[model samples]
Target: MKKVHLGLDVGGTASRWVACDPDGQVVARGSVDGATAHVFNPAERQRLGTALAQMAAALVAEDLVAVGMVGGLTGFGSAAAAEIAALAKEALGLAPAQLLLTDDIVLAFAAQFQPGEGHLISAGTGSIGVHVAADGKMTRVGGRGILIDDAGSGSWIALRALDAIYRVLDRTGSLAEVQRLAGALFALVGGSEWHHVRQYVYGGDRGRIGALAVGVAQAAEAGDATALQILAEAGAELARLAQALQTRAGDRPIALIGGVLNLHGSIGTEIQNRLPGTPISQPNSDTALAAARLQASGEEHAWRAILASMLTPPVPSLGSSVSAAAP
Candidate 1:
């Protein structure tokens, strides 16, 4: 029998789902815009569950799997993976074929690292590095985001921008180049009087922090002194993050994904310069497509075992090791 399956990718700043036939050709796709990852919110969490239900009604399927950051990596996100599996398995009450939950990086690694001699670095709202060696030994670094990790991430750039802004506001520093960029942030467009910049900064930490990278880059391109500083700082941080990964990682191809690395001079140059001669390439496929591959593959990866062993209930708090707001 031909196997038709559904794969879900609940990742940073967005929620996405895909349906694929046994041949791995995509049949349907669904997506929702999210600033703070719905898996972290109760009300929004239903968006994923509901979307899956709707997809189930539309198509007959054999298996449905949701992979990505839903793994119990962080505390609040701990149950996201299982909750999704449960919803598909229990809530939607769909007959299960093979259901699996996992971290987003693992799927990307599976899709990109065919020979398994590579490291997948995801830099977006946050950043994480996963290494798949020739022997299939996986080592992850810098996945904690702005709080603990995410060194080359967008939020990391934004935090540096904020620091530059603070430095300027306090008159403790000079951002002659970055000032113009900061002005854009405060400046308004058209006749609209909405002060989204101010509101965004004050609204919440996770909400604005990750997305701030875009604005910072905009300012830097415009010759904003402070914005350039922010980008430079982020570039350095990106290098350091890459350095840490390269040091620990054995010889492997390094694949860089997410918005931060895509930009030419700002971050890519920094990372490439720091980690010279390393194989840094683009994502072979998107996270959603990777999710679909993982969905179709029935083999249970060892990543799940690591997650289960690490998260033995009563997860440790963010104590002194990490500050409250990641940014």
Candidate 2:
């Protein structure tokens, strides 16, 4: 039987798994619904376990044995780390020594840079800046989650767009001026009624809300001024995260990662404008694959080299625009 190392990148919006052989060749890969590491929450814990089981079953069906597993999970604080680790071990059929778990941001940083080499700005469902020093100390800025405002994140952008749309309605009693944005957002929400927006915002999880960022991006692409401004502000907010980390970690190169950066070009451009002369690269490498390589090599330097070799050009947008119909 062929043995493989498993790497899992589990976030609020998506969970991806990659299996790599000893020679660092990808053997299998899969993705499932996203889950967080806040295992103390019963619902989240169940989602995490289910996602792990799904990935494990897929590997088993492919006749691959997992010898080691590394997982990077969102909300992987100390409070629920042990429980989450145990869940992964049981679901993936790995022993305690064969498993390593960490925060998703840490995994993302490792995928892009070796410790002390640079700072990482990740803007997904949430936003955060992370710097891991050579001495093994980690500094983090922002990423407080949606409740406290993960500024410049997908969720933040979605919230800002919704807030703006409603404000326009309140003042003008119509969405005529911001019809493009309003229509885009309402389409995602499934209705333009107040109850629809209220239910979607209050009844669903953060991931569901974060998904609305797509509509905001779409509206911006269609030349909606409000949507464009929101995205630009998001970029500035993300830059603030990088800047905060710079104050403590010094001026290191910045690596931007996450779905939010992929939403539009303006976010990346705004970040560059705010921090001139700072080297920023959005390396295109799979975080799960990087985790697998890291687990296989057990050496950060070796994993970093492997990750660097896989870097591709920055992601490009389709440049397609959607026509918005008023709701």
> Which candidate gets the maximum lDDT versus the true structure?
2
lDDT for model 2 comes to: 0.84
Q: Which candidate has the top score in TM-score?
A: 2
Q: Which stretches of candidate 2 lie over 4 Å from their true place?
A: 300-327
Q: Rate residue 193 of model 2 by lDDT.
A: 98
The whole-model C-alpha lDDT of candidate 1 against the native structure comes to: 0.58
TM values, all candidates: 0.75, 0.89
**What is residue 161's positional error in candidate 1, in angstroms?**
0.9
Backbone Cα, N, C clashes tallied per candidate: 9, 0
| Predicted candidate 1 versus true structure: per-residue lDDT over 1-327, tens digit per residue | 234555655543565666666566886677644322245577656665565566555444534433221121122234455556566665344443355555566656665765356777777778777665545445666666566667767777777666666566568545453566565555422111236655665566653577667767777777666676666666677666556656876656678777787543767777777777887787646666665655555433554454444334444576634212112
Could you tell me which 10 consecutive residues in candidate 1 have the lowest summed lDDT?
67-76
lDDT of each: 0.58, 0.84
